[model samples]
Target: MIVLGVESSCDETGLALYDTQHGLLSHALYSQVAMHEEYGGVVPELASRDHIRRAIPLLQQALADAKLAPQDIDAIAYTQGPGLAGALLVGSSVACSLGLALDKPVLGIHHLEGHLLSPLLAKEPPEFPFIALLVSGGHTQLMRVDGVGQYTLLGETLDDAAGEAFDKSAKLLGLGYPGGPAISRLAEFGDPLAYKLPRPMLHSKDFNFSFSGLKTAVLTVVKNHEEKVIANICEQDKANIARGFVDAIVDVLTAKCVNALKHTGLKRLVIAGGVGANSQLRASLNEAAAKKRFKVYYPELEFCTDNGAMIAFAGAMRLQINPDAAQRDYSFNVRPRWPLDEIKVV
Candidate 1:
């Protein structure tokens, strides 16, 4: 089956064609990161508008790249919720309309599910019954995946998500927007032991996490340094702070992951979402998993962020598992918030 997927959850416009027999036939994406860079955060209104402008062109490009006509598309899939409503609408509207025009089946996919299923796109995908660590800008969660739609929420953030913490911490340190990557890069030069930071709730028997305290600790350090020194700290200080901050987060994440695996007795781990792009987090998880002899899987770096291929792949997988689940109706709705476990395959 050839499934065309569209993603417009936030600042990205992505379109792709996924063939069950041939794998990812074509994928295209346009990012508004540069436009939102000046504001140091995503502007919802601007992000929605850009999605409207970019979705169609990207869809056309995806079709062209796949060398397929509209008739060749067997189904249409789009991110339906848990994202900016307006941005979600752009993709949902276009996809539903196209499906209606072609009289093809349409499926509304959860944005997080796209991230959860992304690892399946790899050359050697992890099988079912794996633990999923979903760390993104809007969400931080750990889930147990038993099947296509079988997900049990193990734990989640009590306050800010991991990616949000990364960005906010970066901003505190005068790093640019999307601070995760920036701080991660600077962390390489800093000493992880230079400034110790709190690892909030890392020892909690429950899989739940807390990062708000860590952010406050960073603020306290910055305020104290500014008050005593009377001027901004040197680059080395910034790097050290960055390193310490990253280390605290990584430690918490790794500990929780290890705990989750121990509790559930699951040996396979799948890392998902934008924060999965973090070099430190990936390296830490990989090294720890290797030591424990647990298999770990992650989507390719380019697929680390939100994109269409994952959505298409997820939708296709769902359809393959249960064809009756495909929606043929043109009516579309955008979900600003939806629970992952509430998702039913058919």
Candidate 2:
């Protein structure tokens, strides 16, 4: 089956065509990072407007890349909720409209599910019954995945997620919007031993994570340094702080993941969501996996962020497992606050 996926959960406009028999045919994505960067963050209205303008052109690009006509598509899928309400509406409306025009089935896919199953698109995919670490825009969760739509939440952040912590800490360092990448890139020049930062709840008995305290710790350090020096924090100091912050986060995440694997006795670990692209976290997890003698999986870099490919691939997988998973109804509504666990088996 050929499924067309649309993703406009946030600042990205993505469209893709996935063939069950041939894998991902083509995906086109346009990010509003540059535009939103001007405002230091995503503006919901701007994001929604951009999605409207980019969706059709991206769909045309995906179709052109796949050498397929709109009539060749068998179904339509879109990220329905757990995102910006306006952005979600744009994709959902576009997808449902296309479904109506083509007389095809349409499915409302959970945004997190797209991130959860993205690693499956990799050449070396993990098997079923693996542990998944979902660290996306505003969420950081650990789940035991028995199969598609079978997820048991192990733990999640009590406050700020890892991505949020990164962005917040970066802001404290006077970094730009979307601070995760900037902080990570600056950490490369840092001396790991220059400063020591606290790892909040690193030794907690449970799998739960707490990055809010860590972000506060960063703020404290920045404020202290500024007060003492009577000047803005220098470049080297910023890098050191970034290094310390990244290291602390990586340690806590790695330790919790190892503990979760041991607790569940699962050897395979699949990391999904935007933060899964972090170089430090990947290196730490790689080392842990090597020493612990387990497998770790991640999506290709292109699929790491919010994108149409994962959404299409996820929708196709759901359909393959349960053809009845989709419906003929073109009337649709989006959920901007849906939870992953609420998704019952189709």
Candidate 3:
């Protein structure tokens, strides 16, 4: 089966085609990061408008790359929820419209589910019954994944997600928007011992996480520093703070994942979502996995963010698992705050 996936849950406009027999055929994405940079964050209305502008052209690009026409697409899938309402509506409308035009079955895929199952599209994917650490933009969670749609929430953040901590802390350090990469980049030059930030819930003995305190710790350091003024803090000082923050987050995440593995007795671990692309976290996880004699898996760098390929691949997997999941009806509603476990198979 050929599945065309649409992902416009946030700032990125992505469209892709996945063939059940041949894997991912083509995907095209346009990120609105630059557009939103000046504003310091995403503007929902502008994001929605850009999606409306980019969706069709991206779809055409994807189709042209795949060497197929709309009729050749066997089904359509779209991220249905857990995002901005306006953004979700734009993708939903575009996908359903195409499904109506092609007379194809349409499926509303949960956005998190798309991220959860993305690693399966890797060349050497892990088998079922593994642990998954999903660190997306607003979500930081650990789950026991048995199979497609078979996810058990193991733990999650009580307040700010890891990505939020990154963004908020980066703002404190005067780093530009989309803070994870920027802060992490600056962290490389920092001395790990210069500023030691707190690692919230590091020893909670439970799988749950909390990064809000950590972010606050960064703020506290910034405001209470004995050195230069906030605006006058040197680049090196900012980098040290960034390093401290990143290390703290990395240590907490790595420890939690390790403990989760020990608790679940699962040897294989899959990392997904945007924050999964963090070099420090990946390195920390790899080191732990190597020492503990377990395996760690990750999606290719491109699939780590919001994209249509994961959605399409997830849809194809669902259909392959149960074809009835798809619906011929084109009418649909967008979900702005859907939970992951709510989609569990009965």
Which residue segments of model 1 deviate by more than 4 Å? Answer: 227-231
Question: Order of candidates by TM-score, top first?
Answer: 3, 2, 1
lDDT of 2 by residue, 1-346 (tens): 9999999999999999999999999999999999999788899999999999999999999999999999999999999988999999999999999999999999999999999999999999999999999999799999999988999999999999999999989888888899999999999989999889999989889999999999999888877884554246679988998999999999999999999999999999999999999999999999999999999999898998999999999899999999988888999899999989999875
Predicted structure 3: lDDT: 0.94
What is the TM-score of each predicted model, taking all chains together?
A: 0.97, 0.98, 0.99
Candidate 2 Cα lDDT to native: 0.93
Note the residue pairs that clash in candidate 1: none
Alpha-carbon local distance difference test for all models: 0.92, 0.93, 0.94
Model 2 bad stretches (over 4 Å): 226-231
The TM-score that candidate 1 achieves is: 0.97
Q: How close is candidate 3 to the true structure, as a TM-score?
A: 0.99
Ranking of models by lDDT: 3, 2, 1
lDDT of 1 by residue, 1-346 (tens): 9999999999999999999999999999999989999999999999999998898899889999999999999999899988998889888999999998999999999999999999999999999999999997889999999988889999999999999899999998888897999999999999978999999998888999899889888888998895444146788999999999999999999999998998999999999999998999999999999899899899998898999999999899999989876778889888999988788844
Q: Residue 209, candidate 2: how far off, in angstroms?
A: 0.8
